[model samples]
Target: MTLGFTALVTAIVGEVAGTMSLRKATTGSKAWFVAVAGSYVFAFSMLSVSLAQGLPLGLAYGIWAAAGVALTAILSKVLFEEPLTPVMGAGIALIVGGVLLIQVGSAY
Candidate 1:
């Protein structure tokens, strides 16, 4: 279970990194294109490993996607000076709450 959780976390990180790289690549950075591709590969690999280690698909994917969105939004605000409005903040909170609910529901 610990290993599975760790893999899930890695998957989330990879996804966030991939998205960030995508932004940079879109701005004409060739190196970021490579990073975007590699990060996605790493993300999916970790996600698959986590599933194989016994994490439920619904639970794992929900957490992975939500964390990715939230982290990406926050990091983009920090790194790229992207605007994070109050509504967006509220949406992120809701996403986090939804993931928690899914996790608790899964335990049963």
Candidate 2:
């Protein structure tokens, strides 16, 4: 895979990890704060790398944000007993669809 795509993937993973760690930190674990901070920094750094490598801002950010929201919601439901209602699932689907549209539009 291209470096830009790889960096974007890393950014998505880092953002998701950071979000998950934030939940732990808020639940009274100070150590998790470190993970949260580090993860966010890494995520943004990778995102910048992707942009520098010629990924359009709109497409890259759209995919990253949509993936982050979807992944975080699913992971939270599994790890923290968070609710994953059908309505929320539908919202996620819409977000993914929108991002896909943005990606396709960017091609033309």
TM-score of 2: 0.96
Clashing residue pairs in candidate 1 are none
Report the C-alpha lDDT of model 2 over 2-106, residue by residue, as the tens digit: 899899999999999999999999997799999999999999999999999999999999999999999999999999999999999999999999999998888
What's model 1's overall lDDT?
Answer: 0.94
Model 1 agreement with the true structure over 15-75: per-residue lDDT tens digits: 9999999999998768899999999999999999999999999999999989998999999
Clashes of each: 0, 0
Per-model CA lDDT versus the true structure: 0.94, 0.96
Per-model TM against the reference: 0.94, 0.96
Candidate 1, residue 44: the lDDT equals 99
Query: Where is model 2 more than 4 Å wrong at Cα?
Result: none
User: Number of the top candidate by lDDT?
Assistant: 2
